[model samples]
Target chain A: MEQNACCSRREHDLQRRVRAFAEERDWGQFHTPKNLAMALAGEVGELIAEFQWLTPEQSAEVMSDPEAGGRVRAEIGDVMIYLTRLADVLGIDLADAALSKLENSALRYPTDQVRGSAAKR
Target chain B: MEQNACCSRREHDLQRRVRAFAEERDWGQFHTPKNLAMALAGEVGELIAEFQWLTPEQSAEVMSDPEAGGRVRAEIGDVMIYLTRLADVLGIDLADAALSKLENSALRYPTDQVRGSAAKR
Candidate 1:
C-alpha cells in the first residue's frame, strides 16, 4: 500500500503537471483525439524502428546500449503522454477502461483455454 | 487526493491480478522483456491499423462507432498491460520515468522556442 501510494502520488503529480503545461500553452485546442492518436502511432513506429533489423537476441539487449535505451525510453514517454491526453480529452477514465477490458480478457483467455497458446483472442 | 487513491487502489489490484494470472499459468518463461516489448509494438500497430484509412475527421469520430471503439479500447488495454509488465521486469518506475522525461521535454521544447511550431525537437 505504501508503494502504491507513492506510485499514485507520482502519477497524479505528472498528470496534473502535464495538463497544466498544455493548458498554459493553449494547446488543448489542437489535442483532438485524432491528432493525439496519430502522434501516438508515429511514436510507436519510432520505437519499433530502433529494433527493426535486430535479431531477437540483439533486440533483447536494447536497454544495455545506453543510447538505444535513452531513445526507447523517450519514445515510450511520448506514447504514454499522447495516450493519457487522448483519454483525458475523451473523458475516459483510463484505470476504469483498463480494468473493464481486463475483466473481459480474463474471461476470453481463461487459463484452461489459453494455456500454452499464443493465439490472440 | 481521494480520486487519486481510487486510481492507485484499482491500478494496484490490477497489477497484482495480472502477475498472478501469469504465474498461475506458468507463462513467465515466455514473457521476457524483449518479447513483451515486441508484443506491445504489435498491439500498437493493431490500434493504428484501425485509423489507417480514415481521414482526420473520420478518425476523430472513431469512438462513435461502437465496433471500432471497442477494438481501439481493447488495444489500448493490451498496450498498457504489456507496458506495465515490461516496466516491472525492468525494475523501472513508469511514473518516475515519465516525470523525468517530461522535465526534459519541457526544457527541450520550451513554450518560447517551440510553441505552435509542430516541429519535433
Candidate 2:
C-alpha cells in the first residue's frame, strides 16, 4: 500500500510493512486486542528493565552508547510494533488516533493550568 | 503568554497553565532533568500499579467504571503532566517532537517487512 501523504511517513510505512508481514503468514488470528495489549505491556516492561537502577545521567548515557542504545531502540521498536499492530487490528489510523487524542487532551489540560505544577488532577 | 498555534490546544493550554503555576511559585529551579525524570517514573509506577493485578477484562473494566476510571485517568494525567512539563522545560514542541519521531520510525520499520508479524528486530 502506498503511504498516506498527511501521515508520518515513518509510522505509516512501518505499519504497512508490518501488516504485510502478518498477511503473508496469516498471523492476524493471534492478534486479539487483549493479547496485543499484553504484548505491548511486555515490551514496555522490557524497555523499563533497560533503565532499572540506572541513574538519570546513566539512563541518558544508555541511549547514547551504541550497544545500550541498540537494545533500547530494539525494545522500543517492539513496543511500537505491538502498538501499531493493535491499532491496525482495531482498524484505527494510528496517526489520526494520535492526533485526535492530542486534541482531546488539549481540552483536558489547559496550558495555563498545567504549566509547571506537578499537581495531579 | 498566549498558547501556540499548530500545537494541541489542550496540551499547550495545559502547559501554559502549568507554567504559570510554576512561575507563580518560582519552581522552575526544581524542575531539573534529574528530578523531573524521577517524578515521571513515580507517576508511571502509579499508572502501572493500577493495572498490575487486574485480568485483561478487569483492566478494561477499570477504565470504564467511573471510580476506577477516574483513578486511571488521574494517573494518566499525572504522567502526561510530567511529560508535558519535561518537554516544556526542555524547550520541546511536544506535537512536533512526536511528528518527527514518527517520521524517523517509518524508515526503521518498512511496511512490507512489518505487516502483521510480531517478530522483534
> Fraction of native Cα contacts kept in each candidate?
0.28, 0.05
Alpha-carbon deviation at A71 in model 2, angstroms: 14
- Model 2 earns a TM-score of 0.54
The regions of model 1 sitting more than 4 angstroms off are A1-10, A52-68, B1-8
Please list the C-alpha lDDT of all candidates, in the order they appear. 0.70, 0.59
* Whole-structure CA lDDT of model 1: 0.70
Candidate 1 per-residue lDDT, tens place, B23-118, comes to 766677777666777787887777678778887778778788998888878777777777666665655556556667778878887887766666
- Off-target runs (Cα >4 Å) in candidate 2 are A1-121, B1-8
Candidate 2's residue-wise lDDT over B87-110, tens digit each? 566455544544444456567666
